[model samples]
Target: MTTENPVHLTPELVENPVGAYAGLRTRPGLGHVVLPGLNAPVRLVTRHEDVKAALAEPRLVRDRSTIPDSEMPDPQAELMAQGADGLPPEYAQYLSGHLALFDGDEHTRRRNPLTRAFTARRVAALRPFVEKTARELIEALAEREQADLLGEFAYPLSTAVICALLGVDAADQDKVCGWIRDFAYGDGSRVLEGLGGVVQYTKDLVTRRRAEPADDLVSALLADGGMADDEIVTVFFLLINTGITPPALFLAHAVLALLDHPDQLERLRAEPELLGRAVPELLRYVTLVRMGATLYATEDFVFAGTGLRKGEAVTVALFAADHDPAAYDAPERLDVAREFGRGDGHLAFGHGPHYCIGAALGRLVTGVVFEELLVRRPAAPELAVDRADVRFGHWPGDGFHLLSLPVRL
Candidate 1:
């Protein structure tokens, strides 16, 4: 049953999401939660079974355009998704071909080309570049007595990987990152402007790649010719926006978690072969995206025994699902050698059709970075400040990330 009061996403909840969501997950039905920046409350599905099923439910669509305005809970609330309320008409085109925001055939059309784009060979090819980038960043970090790993190493490394994959010029990569930062985590005022800048820059990059074809993602997509210019721009836009943040956040958090659990750290270093298992466990333990993308109900239906009306927004709590005791034994505990067979893996990268297309690359990036940091370096980095001084950057639905993970090398 729905609670009498909606759960406000307060600082306490965001700071300790696992504990907060644990209390909600045991409730009989979905919880109505007010996420920051949204005008209305969204139904939060927390159980692993419900979240997994909800993700693949055909009735729940990601694209708001599929359902008419009349069906909405409130027409004005439509724009509130990802802070899009006052977006100008011209800026709308930049959002086209965003695979995560589409549904059914449209999603398939947009995603199929990208699926081919991230082929096994393509991801495998990226490993060397990932390794090289991580090595350089780590070396740079070693020179300093203390370093903010998030800024000094994680963001730069992830940004470089995405930039290299997208054929972005080294000079322009920093600017692109700034635009993304403003667009994603900035205050309300610069959202549209930041988005415009990123899309326009991608458009320019795509145009250049069109003229001078290179061995890059843009060139590869251009070669496919399945998507239009605007679609390609948005696709790259999505990739850059998503590519940099998640893996970077994962890297920073994984380091903090390992430092907190030295036993696990030693276990990982001792049995490097367990890195594969440790990666997923770390992902589950340190959730990057606390809430999955908002999904709108296409029609009235009973979900997890609760009636969900048409146009109601539902968010799968990825953090909660990955930590659900039903799915994972001692869900709160971090195990480096956690054995997860197929169909039972953690939902950290998500599940079903909308599963993150960059899963392999993300895994590759995280693995390579850890290998370089833990195995090659072999020195356990200590927190520069007191444990209490460590702070996390939290955005409404994006979850907590390290603003600056200060570490003494």
Candidate 2:
């Protein structure tokens, strides 16, 4: 067993947390624990079974209206999946349109267009561009003998793809990237502080897109996304700022998992097709974005033999649910070869009507990027970097961090 006290908080877990989690899972489930020194009653759902049941059960909600914003909801699950502590009006408005934050048919509507645009076929069409981009980036890194994959490659790659989908200019890419960075790297306070700048940028872009329409989603939205400037500004704010935040962090986590599992890496290279199935598993393995938006129970519901309070906070313990052994056999094991054959499912992208809309986009990016990494740099050098050096935003369940790898060329 690891010697580090579970009560002690460290940046290491925020970077590569599988070990810490494995230890945590072994502890007794019914104990009430404080987050470091915080005075909040938190129920840690470490076992695979408990996490799974909690996620599927409707009694566990996400909306902040159900829980007091100032009070942290069990620090064990950090990084507010909804909108951090305290839902500000502008931020709330921004989140209302983002498909991940919304529920019901409304989310379906905003998602439909993008969904159609990113079918398996569409993602396949993107392979060539992805390969080309990855190849060039790797070549540059190999030449330099070192690279910050998160900042240098992953961030630009994902952001560029999102922009292309929205019809934003490459010139606007850096400015747009700033919002996601602040959200990903900055704490809860910084997120609110940086919101105004992101909103202004999105609003300006919308104004331009409205006056001079283009063949992008923004134009289509102006013509069809079914929202005016005010509404468009809100969605745009979420798209750049909020939506990109968690994903950026999690993608880094997935990459770290691959780096740690060399055998799995080789297996992936042998059969690239496994990527489709493996993406979900990888999402589960890291449980990086520990939870989804805290949902508020609209009506009375009973689950797991527990009576839930109405308007009580219902949260999908995403990390818990994804890692739950009930859904995955030997949940802790990173088995790339496991067929999983078939099963219930994972909470990586959430569940029910509120499922993640950008899920396809994220999977597409991660999978394609993985394939490209193998193809571009087939050298397969082992990473030589300390876990502590790879730090991330200090939040419970935070993912990724400063991953600086020194591998043999």
Candidate 3:
């Protein structure tokens, strides 16, 4: 298992994730690598089949506390120590009660209600509003020759939609968005400050919703007798935060991918209905939520033909799996019309019980954004800056994130 040079996590690799993933796939099965910030050894599952199997295994657990101190990464250990305790219950849950960190019955109980809230029918109903929002945002850029698509279009559109869903007041949307960005992707030291701002805001929102319920999901969760105040706050925190970053990044990358492959972009423009197939393909190509999902071996077992001790941590490389040569015909090609079969499925949203709950909403928002942008624009938008000049930020536990995307219509 030892090598002269192990893969070291770095911003360079994050900037060009596809290349990094391709290299990792060359390993025997699972490759052992050290994450930079955490500075700890983790079993990196790269191949599509191996990543899928690991995700489906019931013996792997999400809770990091179960792992022995000797096995846990220092950063992870520090994070776990900060879990809900002295803080108010609502704030505690907001910090540590996300669905990604739960397992078994508790995970099931929390997820079911949220699942019902984001049904296909419900997401479809949001299409008109999403389209309207996209149109408005795009039209606002009419007076300018060039704009930062990420800030003016993607961020606002996502924030508006998620705020609408969570019953967040229009006046407070900017503040909430700021806090979420800092919490998820900002400086490490300021993360706690960002978390505090979000928790306090969510707690206040929950109280207001409880006193006077609305048609929004937050109100619905609060009214549910089975859910406690802290649980409701936690749900709100997860939904609001997750709702923004992934979709925003997806939009930015989708636009970048489409522009890079003009032939595919032309095909999409010629036949707009292909959005159904195109969105999934784009998701597969851009696997924005690259890392974050980790599983601990509940007991001693062999994974990917390698023996693993109990309580060892495994990080599933969704980006690597999505681009696995064994899974797709031309894994590196960005073909919007590429067809996917059951076994050759993409793991962009993950697999098994922990798959993204907001998958439908994400698709709707992204589809509507592209439909509106491509259909209504006088001409296709072009990158104002050279593609090579574009910059991205790499959050260690999270994935590569686009900081700014400048374009001209």
Candidate 4:
């Protein structure tokens, strides 16, 4: 229950979390870990079964506001209760109102409108745009001798697509997305500053959209009139920021993963239709989100044979769960045709009500990226730098936050 023998996050752990968690996964009950972003040590859930269950457990809640003040843990809960860490007031104001931080009816109210945009038909309709954008980017990359795939292709394509959806001006897309990129993936010191810019930009964009409605998500949300101005601003901010990072990072990592496993890449290339399977497999293999959003226990309960106290924070090791040997035979191997396209059981997008809202978009963009880069191309791009030379950003709670993946076309 306590972190007396807590696993401290280290460079080694971030570099290879699956291997680091393997020992803990085989043991009974949950392990304890001191992750960087968390205010206190948390109960670490690693097994595939436990993680899947924990994700949907009603007693486990993402909105800390729902927990009673009396049950809140001392300094840990108090510190987190402060909310923004050290974010500027203007920035924190918008940041705090986002739908992801809410629970129950409030969460449902905020999520319902957005769900219309990500439906199967809607996502399918995006294929053409995704493919066209990818083709243009790939063609540009082909012209270059060597380029950082993340910066040149993945980031641009992701930013452009999300901006198009949100009606971000073509001229301002780069500036807006650059701030989000800096906030999400930058070195520690600049995060708050970068986030400040994003909030301010979103605030102005919201004002513009209100004055002159356009045919985009922002205008649509405004037209719905279900959410207040502040709520709409935060939602817009979330869409732009989340929309860009996950897909961009996933695309870069997918390319790297395939390049690393040539046999799997060849398999995918031969069976071009295997993308549906390949996407989830690569997601499971790479595990973009190293940890799921921290959930606080609403009541005292036993989970995974461990006695969890009310208000205790539970963090799921998503990367570990996806690679869990008990769940997947030959879990370490990257098989494009794994499970014959079932695409079930991976905690990459998580499970339950709070599952990633952008799951469909993430899949669509990354699938299109691979389609343009590998299946339809004459040949795949080659890593310009030694595979070992390429590095991921050392951000806690994020897996495979690729800094730059240099490749030659």
Candidate 5:
């Protein structure tokens, strides 16, 4: 509460979030601060407990006009949603638009429609196909002696799963992957400025699916008729793209974590019982999406003695909150078997109604792939690319650019 200068979580800080979040939390004020180049002043919620409390608060809106733009990058989400610019108003109207950015009756209405798509029964049905794909990719990588798991493994794995669920052509997975890259690569400012014509692609795809329905989620939605075209675009944007980028990055980090902690890897390898717990541990340890997207204050509100002004933007940093000393004891230390949610919940996925809908599916895909990654090659290969040398065409959120690694294949 005492700091004068605003804290900006820039692209540079995202590269190594462990230190960045740690350093940001230790500043003079944890509640609020401001940045210069950004459009408006921001209030930064540094601690995990506070961020959790804020995510559930209705007063904190996602619209830019509700919150200051300087603190968080997503204000345009409101503008985009409102059709403030020439862009369609319903651009973010889908499940990816999901509950994360929505509120109350409308949020429920939208989510209720798509809830079944991600149910355990549905995802379980697709596991055989997912497993087959993972093994095939691994086998292909083994043949080459190197493959970037992000590009070659995690990216396609997540992409294919979602696309398949949506009933899109599995062969078009590469094109969807490219669109996913353009959407969240951090360079994108809006549907128009950043992802030029990206929305149009989603529209065209949905139109085609509607013209000729298929066995996918998109076809089902078209049959249901609750979703509008632009809304479909938004849903497609979120569903087909988001969520797994972090896991892709986390996959790379998990390997790094496991290699250094051979005992942990040995435990998982020796007994598969540890896979589920290990997944959370790896997420907790790697802690992707260092800074969660911004949220605006819809009206005047206060939390923990911090008086927040109306329309001021604030950040609920997921990484900083995840690693807060108060949230998790020795959070920096990675323990694969540690009981997550029992001790302290991790915010790798955002909290509350807006939580990542695909979280379970994402974890499922990542776990299956990770399990196969180790099984396919017992000795994790040395990444041909240096850890420091890797870079995503986009910034942190795209996941690390893990293009290739020299494995013991």
Candidate 6:
């Protein structure tokens, strides 16, 4: 069905998604909006309660195969088919089957091994290393009077940490980071090629890990026999891609948010321990990974009193849900000390079975990066560019990335 006045997910809305989300919340719980590059209308779940309930609803599945292709929007299939051409059929299928696209037992099977690898103990064990990496990056930034924090510090820091975790070589970091950056923001014309490069690189890495296992997450995953070589490659690609960008964006966003709220910044500086509370708040406040949690209805179901036909796409606006007034007090404010223990935690990492596996690590890395930057930096960083001048771009479904965040140390 076509929308009469559909809300397109444009760059402007992406820049200020919360504002759009707020307007949507005023409507009925589940409303329809037409996104660009798609032929069908998407059921946008905006309210906090409905969003939370929808995320956990078994009727809304991730696997698209459950529904006939002709029943859904053409863009849905195009998005899945992306980057699959010119590759072996098996590899192509693997490329399309990311963890987020799986549900039920299949999702569990694919996700369990990785979940085991990123246990709390494992994340905690990496604290010292994360701290060391953050310190080095901050030190290098200290040498320069002015630098783009996103380019110079956050990106490299995140890439280095993920490389260390995945057992990727230091020599190949620049190459990998470049590929990730391109794939994250490259226009449609080049994204497929960029993804091909990443897939090929991951294949090589998986082969090397198999031949010579190392003390890293990739080697550990290889040691586990449940996943195929292609599955391993896809999982590795997802891990590195997901691991690097969100945390990097979060770091920049956290810094930007804190800087904007000097009172919170001073409070954090005065009490470093407040980070236990602060990090969660930043995760909620920044909400860097905006949109693109797409799910399909498995059968006829009533969602928020709306009759969702089979194969219809449901896109949850997490940024809007996190800012819902019913969920939190002063939802728009960036209160580092806000208490989140009482209710459902922030939807930044998402909700339900497909919740991000790298969440703990992202938090650990971000927390360490913020702690070191605040504690070790000789002076707090001031924006080198005007706040209004900051530029943003999104790779449709990946992240709303800051193209540049120049700052004076």
Best by TM-score: 1
> In candidate 2, what are the lDDT values of residues 310-329, reduced to their tens digit?
55344344665555555667
TM-score of 1: 0.90
Residue pairs with colliding backbones in model 4 are none
Local distance difference test, per candidate? 0.80, 0.58, 0.76, 0.77, 0.64, 0.76
All-Cα superposition RMSD per candidate? 2.8, 5.6, 3.3, 3.0, 4.9, 3.1
1 or 2, which is superior by lDDT?
Answer: 1
- TM-score for each of the candidates: 0.90, 0.74, 0.89, 0.89, 0.79, 0.89
lDDT of 3 by residue, 81-119 (tens): 543325555456465788998888988888887876666
- Mark the regions of model 4 whose C-alpha exceeds 4 Å error after superposition: 14-18, 36-39, 70-86, 171-175, 178-212, 340-343, 397-400
- At residue 288, candidate 5 shows an lDDT of 70
Global Cα lDDT for candidate 2: 0.58
Task: State the displacement of the C-alpha of residue 398, model 3, in Å, after optimal TM-score superposition.
Answer: 5.5
- Tens-place lDDT per residue, model 6, 287-404, is 7766646788888888987888888888887777778898888888888788886533688888889888888888788778777887456567888878889877655433366777
In terms of lDDT, the best-performing candidate is 1
Once fitted onto the true fold, the runs of candidate 3 whose alpha carbons sit more than 4 angstroms away are: 3-5, 14-20, 67-75, 78-92, 170-197, 342-344, 397-399
Per residue, candidate 1 scores C-alpha lDDT tens digits across 1-409 of 3435778776457446467788888888787887654456788888999999999899988887788863544322444445455778776666544677888888888888788777888888989888888888888888998998887788788777887888888888788777776776445567777788888888898889889998888888888887898888877668866888678778989999999999999988888899999988898888778788889888889999788888888888888888888888888888999999884388888889999888889888888977889866657788999999998656655456677899976
2 or 3: which has the higher TM-score? Answer: 3
Worst 10 residues of 1 by lDDT: 70-79
Which pairs of residues collide in candidate 6? Answer: none
Write one digit per residue (lDDT tens) for candidate 5, span 66-104: 344444334334423443345444543443364455566
